[model samples]
Target: MKLKTSFIQLPLLFDAQRLLAEINALDASCWRDHPQKFPGNFALPLISVEGDPANDGVAGPMRPTPYLEHCPYLMQVLEKIGAVWGRSRLMKLSGHAEVKPHVDLNYYWRERVRVHVPVVTQPAVRFICGDEEVNMKAGECWLFDTWRMHRVINDAAAERIHLVADTVGSERFWNTVDRGRDPFAGSVTENWHPETFSGLASPSPPRLTYESVNFPDVMTPWELREHLLFLLDDTRPHEQLARVRQIASRFITVWQEIWAAHGDAPHAWPIYREKLDAFEQQIHRFAGELKFNSNMSFIEGMNGLIFIGALGDRRQPTATQGMRRAS
Candidate 1:
C-alpha cells in the first residue's frame, strides 16, 4: 500500500513513565559517538554488533548489548515493538542539538524500516520529514520512510531519548499499521516492468569522462533504486513487490534510452557514463564495508534479486563479491 501520509502512528502505546525511569537507570557514560554524528550526541546501543560498542560504527547481526540485558523493563518494551528487530539502540541527543538533513543510502536502509519509541522528549523537540514535521512526545511509537530526507532537532532544555529499532516489516508490524493506516497496499504497474530488452539497437563507441551532478531537493537516481528495492524487501505480500518492480524497471530503461542516444550525441553520454560508473562503484564499496557489520550475505543476495536486475548492464558487481575481491 502506498503511504497515505508522511508519518504513521502505530496502534500500540507504552507506559512512558516506566520507560523513562528505566532509560535513566542505564549508565549514561556508555553512549558513544553515533556514526551519523547525530548533530552532537551519543547513542546507547541496545542491539548491535558482538564486539565493543565503542568501536562498531554501523549495522550488523542482531547482537544484544550488556545494557539491553541489564534493563529488563526496556527489553520487554522492545519485544512488544516487533518480532524481528535488527541493529537497534537507545539514541540520546543533547538539548539544543540537531541532526542535519540526510537520507540513509545503504542496502540496510533499503531493507529496514526504523521504528521510534520515545522515552524522553519535550514539545521543543521536532522531527522534520520532507515537507511535514512533528513533535513526537514521550511513549509514542511512530515511523517514517528514512529513504526520504528526514532529520531531528531537539530544542528542549533537557535531553531527547528514544528507543530506535529496525525491522523488515513482519505480520505483527503490518497488523499494527493495518489497524490504523495501511501503507503497503498497491498493485504493480506494467510500465515499471519494461518491455523485454532482447534486440535493442547498439550505439556507436564513444570517449568517456566522469562527472557528477548535485541535486539538493532529493536523492539521486541510484539512491532511489536502492531505496525502492529495500522497500520491496521489507514489505509483506507478493503483490506489493510488483509496484516497486515496475518503478525500478522504468528508471533503468529510461537510462537505456539516453544511452542509445550516444550515436547522435556522444559527448554527454560519455560524461554521464562516467558518473554512473562511479555511482555503481560506490555501491560496491559500501557493500564491502558492511561485511564486518554482518551484512555481507544480505547484500550479496540482492544482486540475484529481480528488482536490481532491472538495471540490466548498468548494475554494478554485487556488493559482496566484486568489491570484496578488489579489497
Candidate 2:
C-alpha cells in the first residue's frame, strides 16, 4: 500500500523496423480523435484482448496481436524489476502529442509499477515525474513509480512508440515469482519508504520566473515576429498568459539594467531610447491582450510582449514593410 521507486534495463534492443511496420498496420484513428487520453496519430489492435473492465466491460483487457508476441524483450525487462506478465497492459504512443501530468488513480496506494519500453523515439520525447525528467531512447526500458505525478510528451518531428505494462501484487510476490534475480539492484534505497519515495515533500511548487520561461535561441527579428504570431494564435490558459506577462516585465528590467551599465558609451543613449520605445509598445500590446489590472507587479509589460512575440515563424520577412504588414 506504499509507493516505491526502482530501476531496470531491458535485456534486448528493440527492433525498430518490425515495430514500425506493425504500428502502421493497426487502426489508430480512434486514439488520434480522443487525443487527451492517447495523443497524436498511432495504430492500435496490434494485439487481441478483452476490453477494459472498468470502461469497456465484457471484452476483458485489450491484448496485443500475435506479431508483437515476439517482443518478449519488454517482458524480460519487467521480470528484472519483479513484475508479472499477465497483470500488465500494453499502450503505444506517437509523435507531437502528450499525456498531461497526472497520478495513476487505480494503483497508486498498491505496490504496482508501470514499465515502459521505448521501441522508437526522438530526443524530444520526455517522461517527467516530479523533479525528474527522463528522456528515453529507442530500445531502452524504464520502470517508473506512477503513484506520484507523471506525464509524457513527444515534441519531436518523428513518431515514438512505447510498450506499457503494469505489475500487480507485492514486492515479495515479485521477488518470489522471479526467483534468484535481484529486482532491487541499482534502485534507490530510499524508494522503499512511501513518505520519502512518494514525492510528498519534494519541494516548494515551482516558481514561474522569467528565466524559467523558454526563449528560442539565436532568433532573428523576423523569426521573433512569427513567434509572437504563434502565441497569439494559440488559445492560452489565463494563468499562462499571466506568467508570460510577468516574464516579459522581468526581461525589460534586465534590458534597462544593461542600458544603465553602458550609459557612458557614445551611442548608448540613442540605442537605449529606440529599444525602450519598441519594448514599451510590446508591453502595451500584451497588457491589452491580458487586460492586466493596474495593481499587477511592474516590469512595464515589455518583457511579456517579447516573450509572447518571440514564438514567431522563422523565415524572415522580405522587407521591414513586410514585417509591418504581417503584424
Q: State which candidate has the highest TM-score.
A: 1
Instruction: List TM-scores for all candidates, in order.
Output: 0.57, 0.41
lDDT of each: 0.54, 0.41
Q: Kindly list the per-residue Cα lDDT of model 2 for residues 134-210, writing each as its tens digit.
A: 78666555566553456778887776667655445445535433332123453633343211111123233222111
Give each model's clash number: 7, 19
Worst 10 residues of 1 by lDDT: 207-216
Give lDDT tens digits, candidate 1, residues 1-327. Answer: 124466776755677677677677777687776653444666777765553455342333456777776666666665555547666777778899887665554444445577888878899998887677888777767787564557788887898888887666667767876554322323422222211111212242111111111111222345555654554454444443454356446645555555555532535545455544554454454433222111233234343332233232343322222112100
After superposing candidate 1 on the true structure, give the runs of residues whose Cα lies further than 4 Å from its correct spot. 1-4, 36-39, 55-59, 181-327
Candidate 1 clashing pairs, residues 3+ apart or interchain = 1-183, 1-184, 1-185, 60-293, 110-230, 188-243, 192-246
Alpha-carbon shift of residue 287 in model 2 (angstroms): 39
